[model samples]
Target: MKPRFTALLTLLVVALLGGCASQPPLRQAKDVDLARYMGTWYVIGHVPYFAEKGDVATADEYRLKPDGDIAVTYHYRKGFDAPEKTWAGKAWLPDPADTAHWKVQLVWPLRSDYVIVDLAPDYRSVLIGLPSRKLMWIMARERQLPAAEYQRLLAVAKAEGFPVDQVRKVPQRCEDLGQAGFEQP
Candidate 1:
């Protein structure tokens, strides 16, 4: 298998097996307006996945498909000067009534729950997590968040059953690239 494929598979498996300790049930965000959530969200912090290891300028973009599924794009770089690596995936609401719960698939026949644990009313901030608390992401519309705001998001994740101590802040200091030229295979 190619290194990228190995990394992606490892990510899905680790997210499922990471948090083995028994814990309280994870809660979904009260509401998620898919329309407002569609855009590039900078990954300010996260419990790093294999694909994201040593990566910087990480972000996820969501586009609504006509079928009500989401067209997902993941962008990352190995270093400040590294050309960006991009990939396409798909996400869909398993239950229409539960908009916060999503089944995301990057590789065929392998899907993981991408729950919206918390979302700001203004759509500027969001917390995405797994039911097992194994993985978590703190994202915002802006690449950099105020110190206080970042801390607040961490607190929220902790309250929501995440292992905040394991969270790593993703570096967003890379120079702006008008368009990334590489795609993951």
Candidate 2:
């Protein structure tokens, strides 16, 4: 093989490998108040999922069940004729440094990644983060929040280095399939 050709091939390989790597900064919330974080949250936006975008006007509600397990309610309206779909799960704090961090095991005992990445000053809104930062969610306590508030959270996310373009408005009702999930308090 010619030396020039070998050099070009090596550069191409390096570029391809670098492109395949994931980029997510390692940062956790500094102060998390679990109690204030609990409540029903409507999914305003989230990272896109290629497989299934089946829920719209999605909301997640959390409360301590009488049995001591954190009860989670995943609700979404599919369409006008389709009734809302609800999935329940249990979550528990696995780390002490940040009680906001929890592991949620659904019906199959499979744990979905969960992290508290953004919050409002008074704890009225929140953003959930996945380990890779590729998956993120913007949530509000009410189904409808002020436009200014939503934009404010978007700015915070951009400042934190999230891919803002990937964020899109989630449907308000199952009339359209939107994505949503619960964030443990």
Candidate 3:
């Protein structure tokens, strides 16, 4: 009877864990004009991660390289006078079928999902997320998003099963950078 009980408990645990797994076949934007999408995007909000916690004035710059790959640079400041942190990497479309889908390789042998799940018609804003819906970023062309627009984006994220409560606003004060030289592509 003890053995049978142990077997039942094992099955129950497996079932419970399975339910916590992410839903499959994650959706991505239908199509993306990589050219229009390439530019400086201020990180207005994001699902907090260890590396980005307490970060402010965060932004991402994307450049289309001659080889068709994208050069990515992430910038952020930990505090008011903290030295800025930068991470440079490359991203590419592994599947030619989907330009909206990209894999970013910031560290060797480890590629992260860079799916464009939602994008503004004029390319002013975009919602990037991973398949697991565990990580997400709400990026925009400028520093701030209107309250209504932000709410709409949050609703869209919630529909996608993201833990919206984990989303935190990122500080973006270009003046803190002491330079307004970055140009949009």
Candidate 4:
């Protein structure tokens, strides 16, 4: 009886693990010029994590370091009058063959996948996705994206198997920027 129970438990564990790992591998952009990709990008929309929920005027700044790693700074405010928040991190190419696929280390020893799934020809907009397709961010060079462009990005994300309805738009009010001392890009 004991042996039978142990075998059943092992089978259950294997099943659970397989289910958790069933997500398809994310596809990354064919070629990304890391130099052109570096700069400030406004977060127009995202499937928010706990830390970024309710955040407004969200933006990410990237700088290429001498060591080849990318320095990252995430900036946002909770509300129009709320205090500004900033989180610093670093990103590096895990596979030398693919510059579009990166591992972002926001905290020590805890890295997350940062794949560039889509990029505009002019480098004015980008769509970033995770391997699980659970997290996504649509960012643009300007603080606000045109309505048509915004909808187009949403469609692309939806087609990629992401929950597009859950993607909340980040508020980029002029008043919010004036207080934060950020000029329009």
lDDT of each: 0.80, 0.64, 0.74, 0.76
Clashing pairs in 2: 55-177, 55-178, 56-178, 57-171, 57-172, 77-174, 78-174, 79-174
Model 3 segments more than 4 A misplaced: 1-21, 174-185
**Cα-based lDDT at residue 82, candidate 4:** 78
For each candidate in turn, the TM-score is 0.87, 0.72, 0.80, 0.80
> What does candidate 4's lDDT look like per residue over 71-140, in tens digits?
9988877676778877777999988789898877655545667889888888999999876777789999
**For candidate 2, lDDT tens digit of each residue in 1-41?**
44334334533433333334366643556587666677788
Q: Put down candidate 1 lDDT per residue, 30-59, tens digits, no spaces.
A: 868889889999988898766667778889
The runs of at least 3 residues in candidate 4 whose Cα sits more than 4 Å from the true structure, single-residue gaps closed, are: 1-21, 174-185
Count of residue pairs whose backbone atoms collide, per candidate: 0, 8, 0, 0
Clashes of 1: 0
Off by over 4 Å in 1: 1-4, 18-22, 174-185
Output the number of the TM-score-best candidate.
1
Candidate 4: residue 6 Cα off by (Å): 39
